[model samples]
Structure formats: structure tokens, C-alpha cells
Target: MGSATTHALAATSAALDAASGVDLDVATQLFTAARTLADSVQLRSALADGAAAPSARTAVINAVFAKEFAPSAVSLLNAAVEQRWSSDADLVAGIEELAVRAAVVADPSTDVEGELFWFSRIVADNPELELALGSRLGDASAKGTLVESLVDGKVSAATSLIISSIVRQPGERRVRAILTQALDIAARQRGRTVATVTTAHDLGASQIDRLRSALSARYRTDVSINVVIDAAVVGGLRVAIGDELIDASVSTRLADLRQRLAG
Candidate 1:
């Protein structure tokens, strides 16, 4: 991410943290605002242009959204436009991310991060399903309805809303990628980091717990572990958290040895 977008997200996240009474309704309003901005080129440019006066942007926000949005949503939207976004696209993403965070906060008891990970895995493991959800030729609303039906009664209401909202506004992202990003955001909301661990075989529950404890100690915060069973790994494991990767898989080791021998 660019510095401008990073700072903008941080500022908006702070605003979200301070805001009270954030519920699913507020999240829905933010999602609506993101879609509205995304669909209008002029409005998106006006709100995201750093050269424009802050007051002018604020006026546009108020004029377009004042009566339709709740007071909290209006305040949050105003706060978002005040920040200098990396680009018009980032402005939209920032708002969408805020909506996801709001959804996470709204349902404190739900295991959204875990649910998103499993959902992403399901999509990854099924090519036809992934194509159905991520294909550009299909109608976005129809894809969203499919997601809602699939997740209904199986996941929390907030998780269902987040997943459906994302499919409807996927932009250029693949379905699984956006779901992974949402999972990371959900983990962050709970003061935890998500680590993806790939192993040749499924890990035992005790092993996962021990790995999570070790990672939390190393990272100095709580950690959530998502395990992927990849037979290609051969042995050992690969763990990725944020930008860091710890690869000890037999396949990676053999590749490195082969390269060394060739040199």
C-alpha cells in the first residue's frame, strides 16, 4: 500500500474505534456509500482529490449523503473524505474496509475470521465454485444471492453480510483473495494476527494450539492459525503471517539444495 492510503486507513480506523453504536446498519450504510462512490466517476474524483479544499469535499459528502445516512455514518464518511487517499480506488477500498470492521464490531461473539478462512478454502478447493462466484460475466447481485444462500444458517449474520457485500463489489479481485483479506481484517479487529500454515498433513488440535501459542509469543500479540493441508509440502510446514514467511517444507528444502548443487 502507498503511504497516503496507509495513513488514511489508520486515521479512519481510529475514527471507527472512537465511534459508538456501530452496528450492522452502520456497516450497511458504509457499504452503500462505497458502492455509490464506486459507480460515480465524478463523485469519486471529487472526494478523493487531495488538491480540493477539505470543506468542498465535506460539502459534497453532506449534500449527497446527509439525509439518507445516519448521523454516525455521515460523520464517518466526512472523516474518510478529509484524509488524503493514495488514489480514488483507495478511497473506495478504505470505505469498504471500514464497513468490514464495523461488521466485525457489530457481532462480537461471531468467529468471522475462522469462518472466512474456511469459506476461502472451500472456494479454493472447488474450481467450479470459484468460477461461479468470481466470474466477471455473471451478474454481481446474482452471485451475492448465491453466497447468501450458501452461507445462510451456517454462519453468523455479520459473516453472511460481509461475504455477500464483498461478492457484490469484488472489483478486480478474485473471490478467494478478497475473502482472505477480509479474514485478515477480521483478525486485526480482534487484536490478533492470522497465520496461514501449510503442511503435508492435517495438524492435530493440540499441535495447532501449541503453534498458535508459540506464534503469539513471538509476535507479541495473539495469533490465529489457519491450516491448509497441501500434500506438495511433503513434510515440515510453511507459515506466513503478514509479509513474513517461514518455510521449512521438504519441497522448498530440496529446491534450495538443487540450486546450490547446480551452482
Candidate 2:
């Protein structure tokens, strides 16, 4: 992991330590939402999309909490969305850590996203590194030693140990994927600004710039975008920012054309 990610995690950890004043019940509800959303891409996108207004986030709570959820919990969720996250993952991980910090011991050095991404990168970059790390040494000490030597002084001791431990965990699968999920959950807690644009084809650089600018103008804050290409769209674009979707796609047009023809 890079120094920057380490520092960010450390800072968040400190914030959590100091977050002692956040209402436990409220924190718990939000924390649960964060984790649940982390596990669901649809949920994360709905909450984080830039096209979605702040009210949309609250509406989600209202829709979700029909009766059982307290009003305060809903309010807290809205507040988190209003606060805004740099990116969906950034906020998701933030929430995860916040919840974890609430219930368990927190090591500031644990940058789940950073560590996971780096591990994946290492695996992609070097087959030897992957084998060495994934090697099934019956001895925990032996496995840990390999990790320490490979990653020590290279990454924080906390991050190195986490990778090593996770690698050797029995029946443990997809540590990186789980971390990615956690990152999404954390993003929810932090109130991430997410924008999604879908087109018949990948957007060009200019289109991306325009999209970003328009989204920022619409939200009055920086927006993060997730772009998807679908040939069915035919042409034009469909943009979803937050909860709002602007369906200006050729597929929508075709559908309308078909309806008109039927009429």
C-alpha cells in the first residue's frame, strides 16, 4: 500500500476513536446499512449516484424503513449523504471502519482498499509473488515469515500481516473481493458522490469531461462516475447520478418508436 492510503486509514482511525460521541443506536443502524449496501452494488449505486439528489438518499431510508426503522436513523442516513464522500468506495470503507471501530479494535494502518488493490496488483505483476504468498505452508510462522520478508518495510506492518493472515485463512475466500465490498459500505457511511453514465459505446474523452462538468454543476460538488457500455442502447446515452437517471438513449427512443407504431 502507498503511504497516502496508509495515512488516510490512519486519519480515519483517529476520527473513529474520536467518534465516541456518535449515538450508538444511530451509528449501529447506519453501520448496518453501510455493510448491507457494501454487499450490494445496486444499493451502493442508488445511494452514491450523483444524479440522485440529497432527498433521494432520505427517500431510500423512507422506502426501506417503512415501519421498523426509527425516524432518527433515517435522518442520520440523510445527513451522511448530505455530507458526501469523495468516491463510493471511499465512503463505504469509511462506514465499515466506523462500524468496526465501534465494535472492535482498530489499527489505523489497515487500509482495506489500498491493501487489497496492492495485493491484486502484486499478483498480476508477479507470478512468483502470488505463489509465494498463496503457498500453503502448514506452519503459520513460515507463511507469516514470507509475508513479512516480502512486504515488511514495503508496507506498514499492519497491512503486511493482514495480507499474510488473510492469505492463509482456512475456508476464507475472496479477501480482496470482501475488502472491495467493505469499501462500498464505507462509501455509504461517508456519503459518496457517484455518477453513472451508460452509452451504446464507451464515452470519448470529451464526453467524459462534459459529463463530469454537468454532473458537478448539477450536484454542486465533485462527482465520481461509473461508465458502462451497452450496445443495445444503439446511440445517445443514459446517465444515472445518485438516484436520478436521464434516459436519453437510443434504446429508449426505439422503445418509444415501437410504442408509437403500436399506437
Query: Best TM-score goes to which candidate?
Result: 1
Evaluated with lDDT, which candidate comes out highest?
1
Off by over 4 Å in 1: 256-263
Model 2 stretches with alpha carbons more than 4 Å out: 1-192
Let me know the TM-score candidate 1 reaches against the reference structure.
Answer: 0.94
TM values, all candidates: 0.94, 0.38
lDDT of 2 by residue, 1-263 (tens): 44433454555555554453344454455556665666677876776666788788768767875365545555545545543555666556555455534323224434433444455556646777555555555554575577677777666444554455444432233444443333343333334455556787887788788988888888886665666667888999898765588999988988999999999
Q: In candidate 1, what are the lDDT values of residues 1-263, reduced to their tens digit?
A: 89999999999999999998899999989988998998899999999999999889989999999999888898899999999998999999999999999999999998999899988988998999899998878897898899999988889989988998988888899899899999999999889999999999999999999999999999999999999999999999999999999999999999999999999
Could you give me the TM-score of model 2 versus the true structure?
0.38
Steric clash pairs (candidate 1): none
Write down the lDDT of every candidate, Cα atoms only.
0.93, 0.57
Q: Candidate 2: deviation at residue 20, Å?
A: 13
Q: Which window of ten consecutive residues has the lowest lDDT sum in model 2?
A: 100-109
Error of 2 at 211 (Å): 0.5
